[model samples]
Target: MSTWMVTGGAGYIGSHVVEAFRAQGIGVVVVDDLSSGHEAFVPADVPFVRTDVQDREAVAAALDEHRVQGVVHLAGFKYAGVSVTRPLHTYTQNVTGTVALLQAMADAGTTDIVFSSSAAVYGTPTVDLVTETTPTLPESPYGESKLVGEWLLRDQARALEGTSTPLRHTSLRYFNVVGSGHDHLYDTSPHNLFPLVLDALVQGRTPTVFGTDYPTPDGTCVRDYVHVADLATSHVAAARALEGGHDLAPVYNLGSGDGVSVRQIMSAVASVTGTPFTPQEAPRRPGDPARIVASGELAARDLDWQMRHTLEQMVESAWRARQAAEAATP
Candidate 1:
């Protein structure tokens, strides 16, 4: 079995990717700083290195020790709004950290990688359905950092081109990842809508909806809310494709061709949690786009991407995992 290193394998999405890799009979080694990832989330059998991706030496050592053939790079500062104020931190974590990882990979001779990119790369896109060809006009520093990371990969591939073993890489862009793949693994992002709403409901507080007067059918923001498990499957697929020397595009969007509105999400949450509290209404957030959905045609063609879970399934699975996490918390 080939071993792949997951940079943030202890976090929610990373943990799911680790699980998916394992299910495919692929070995996985995890390197995480525990900044936002929990050690418990990593399986006991998997080797876990407690270090940040910025620590080039540690990452390289882990790669060498594990005989890692490739990497699923997922560690970074992911909050777009926070990145606006903490641009330096975001750049350091996302851009500089990626640079260090790439350098380490080059030094250790591990070339294949599947980057955890984001739809933020196309900030407030004018097109209703974004494709891989959509022009990247990142708005926040976080989005900019992700775009820079993709550039780093492209440049590295170029630099290593025509070599005996050139770098092979692909980046997966996604939006609004929700739900839980494992009972112990749940989204812990304080800024994410699913977790925020679930956390509020768990704490007996009413959730708030930012806007309800968008140009959409329901007058609420519509987004491509793909389930985390479905997202993880694509990551594993990309890794396998790279391992098999299959050529892939530089980037692909793992998205729902159609999308769900915030109102629809709230209704699903209510039905799943058995909580019937009306969400508090608030003015639209500045720079908030009314609708942003991406077509997963490329991902489906290359990575076996599919929307296996319905909106209700996503909500219920997420709620169950949230409840499990809360119960486990001391």
Candidate 2:
């Protein structure tokens, strides 16, 4: 089995990717700093390297020791709102870390990479349905850092053209990734909508829906929400595509063709958790887009991307995992 090094494999999304890869009989070695990831999230059998991705020597050593053939880069500061205040930290984690990882990959001669990018790169796009062709006008430093990571991959690939080992890479851009693939794994992002709402209910607080008077049909913001499992499978597919010598576009959007609104999500959560509570209405967050959904046609065609789970399924799985985590906590 070919080995792949997942940079943030202990993370919510990365852990799911690790699970998916292992399910396909692929070898996975995880390198995580545990900044926002729990060591328990990584399977006991997998080789776990507890170090920051920015540490070039450590990452390179992990790659060499594991005989890793490819890399799944997911480590970064992902909170967009907090990134506005902590721009330097976001850049260092996402941008500098990516550069270090790429350098390590070059040193190790491991070229294939699958990057975990975000829909934030579009930055409140005017287009109703965002495509890869949409301009990347990243608003927050976090988004900018992600875009820069993509640029680094592109430039590195170009620089390696015609080499014996050309860089092979593709970045997956996604919006509002939610749900859990395993009962043991759950989204822990304090800024994500699903986790925030789940946390509110777990803490006996009413979840707030900011600005419900959006121009959408339900008067709430409509955004793409793909299940974490579905997203993970696509990442594995991308890696396989690269390994198989298939040419892929530089970026692909893993999105729901048409998305669920915030109100619909709240309704699903209420139904799943068996707790019916009207969400508190709050003022519109400045710079919050009214609606931003993307077409997954590119990824669907190339990477087997699809919304395999319904909104209710996403909520149910997430609630179950959250409950499991709470039960296990002291």
lDDT of 2 by residue, 1-330 (tens): 799999899999999999999999999999999999989999999999999999999999989999998999999999887888899999999999999999999888897999999998998888889999999998889889999999999999999999987899999997989999899999998778999899999999999998878888988888999999999999999999999899999999998978789999999999988999999998876546778799999999999998999888999999999999999999
Positional deviation of residue 127's Cα in model 2 after best superposition, in angstroms? 1.6
> lDDT for model 2, on a 0 to 1 scale?
0.93
Error of 2 at 216 (Å): 3.1
lDDT of each: 0.92, 0.93
Q: What is the model-wide C-alpha lDDT for candidate 1? A: 0.92
Candidate 1 positional error at 324, Å: 1.2
- TM for every model, in the order presented, reads 0.97, 0.97
Instruction: Give one digit per residue, the lDDT tens place, for model 1 in 176-241.
Output: 899987888999898888998999999999999988898899888899999999999999999999
What is candidate 1's CA lDDT for residue 242?
Answer: 98
Clash number by candidate, in order: 0, 0
